[model samples]
Target: MWLRVGSYPDRELAMEMASKLRNAGVRVEVKEYVEWDLTEKYLLKGKLGELEEYEEAQEWKRYADIIRELIRNGMEVEAFEREFLKRAMPEEFEIVEKARSDEITDDELVDAVDAMMKLSLLLSSVYGFLKANGIEVGEYIQGNLPEDPEIIIELDDWAEGCEKVYYLDFVPSYEISVDVLSAIRGGAEIHGMEGAVVDAASRVLMNLIAGIDETNDIEELKNYAVGVIEDSKEFDADVYVDAEEVFEIMLRSLEKAGVIRISGKKVKFRR
Candidate 1:
């Protein structure tokens, strides 16, 4: 038989309680004992000595509700680990205060969780698009979220079917270290031979199509694009364009004015 020091209806609260208790010289064993719903569950996260099968209690729903309320209000899950709650409940102390200088704040943890949830939904939307295009999508490895909260998505079976090289990172309206960008582009240039070829081909075609004089030879266009790309590589290619809104407006205007029209497999442009 084990002594029950505290009982939490959710795993988050239970884990915090166990951690705090252990810090304060208490021996406790924590485990999830019941599943109530996809989001809410009763966890038997306190006690010492014995591990036994436990069923959901009548008051489990009430405890779960309390935990959920705190979470919804943007409170850190560790807020439950406070000393007052430990002493007032009698069921749960002088908390062993650990240095929190390196620890992330409760607010930051909440924000990170919120960001990940939104990112998951966005990824689901993209999965739907891929499935619609007859691509088979499978479960992806979801590693621990980075501290900075950036989503890195790698798609398979799109266009190049995993044979193409593409590297693009969006920092979400913020500036990132130029050193990081340099490293990324350098790595890209090394492993992106296929991408370079593709880019060169597209640039050459655009140049020839938009030229004042008509050029019908594919070989000549390829040579020109290669020369231009190689020549331009030595110059600073880093450019910051703050005209995203302006570009959006231009795109809408072009669509409305029919300056560029897209019809299945064909794009018509006004000369």
Candidate 2:
């Protein structure tokens, strides 16, 4: 997948940023977009596939595309069923064939199909919930079951009837520059500030880093940073004197440190 890392009105600047990141061992790509005869913008994107979950998503998408194509090619239901059985495990094929031949009546088949459709809808809802909660479907498939009994019951009911289930696990993924992480962890001076100020800035920076994955909008990140600072002030008012000002300063420092790039209304992480 290609993730937008930076945007610039000037093509040269965008390419320059891409080159810099590429030289630093990060995969980068630059593309140009033109407005309706008004303006042109350059976008810098980074390729992401380092995670097993990402790879799984890609493979799942490919498989879905293949199935879609097969359907579009006018495959009959019997042909499709044969194809499905060809791909099914031996035990699964036996169970499904037996159900079709002897175990399932006409009304029971209708009920089973209805339940399957309901289960599909339920899985879609679950997928959206997991994504919103920062979960990966591939990770969930690898033995990360939900803790809630109701959720487990729903899943088990569906899986018992259908003989298959898809799931995802919650795991927040964020990439931060090594230098920035080291500075934050080692308590290094940030733009000549130390102690509480550094701690506050580090906390805000980490939040911003995590937030950027969700949104690259500069204002959104700034607002999120201010929220973090405000939450911290509830504990130690002296640590953060001005949330907005502190966020601005930290953003500039991050830009100066080559950990991030700001262009117009967008902020992009280098990593």
Candidate 3:
């Protein structure tokens, strides 16, 4: 997917110019990209840290910090341990042991790529299913509808049953479990294939993406992104998220703050 910078009447001429630039050793490669706005206090940091160190530091450092901060703030020992320390310490040890060395195995890298591909495909299928069923989904940050798009985060919040904080909305969009996807890929027969599996997967997905919309300041977005980075560090899996993708969904908040304007993948200061 080529990122179109500007459009001219002559498409051939543009391609020719691009080719000439590449021939002139400009290191040109074309790829598609998405733009989005973020909210919360973490998404605006604009950097994805080194994955190895990120993994090691987040589990131990963040766990210790949260615990220490809580205690320093005069929180009760039992409550602090139960709420944060106990949960963080075990996982910290597990992640530190698993990610102690910097080198990643080839199989682990391949698994990460495969998992991403499966998720992409599943999102595409879900988007199609929802659109066919007459549930309209608008792009959350861009404030527009995308054509032939996958992974449509809703622009508005809606409640499903008693849950009031279902910000990401879609109908007939089955939130399948990672296990089901893994099972199917592993050639295992999905038992109770119809309603049971679908409902379970949907429940899992809902829980995973469930959060209330907070169209607050960019500071909040930065904090939220930092939390995600720290959380990723605690896990055993390898996740290499790009800096832009991390904050794109939160760009709307920046725009809402009257600081900038976003056009496609390009952003600029508001006049």
* Candidate with the greatest TM-score versus the true structure: 2
* Clash counts for all predictions: 0, 0, 25
What's every prediction's RMSD, in angstroms? 24.4, 24.0, 28.7
Q: Model 3: per-residue lDDT, tens digit, 26-72? A: 33333323333343221111111322233322343343344334444
Best by lDDT: 2
TM-score of each: 0.20, 0.26, 0.17
Error of 2 at 46 (Å): 80
51 Cα displacement, candidate 2 (Å): 82
Residue pairs in clash, model 2: none
lDDT of each: 0.33, 0.45, 0.34
| True-vs-predicted CA distance for residue 156, candidate 2, Å | 80
Off by over 4 Å in 2: 1-182, 185-194, 228-242
Q: Candidates 2 and 3: which is better by TM-score? A: 2
What does candidate 1's lDDT look like per residue over 6-99, in tens digits? 3344344345444543443333466545433222222232221121222322222333233334334343323532422333222212111211
- Order the candidate numbers by lDDT, best to worst: 2, 3, 1
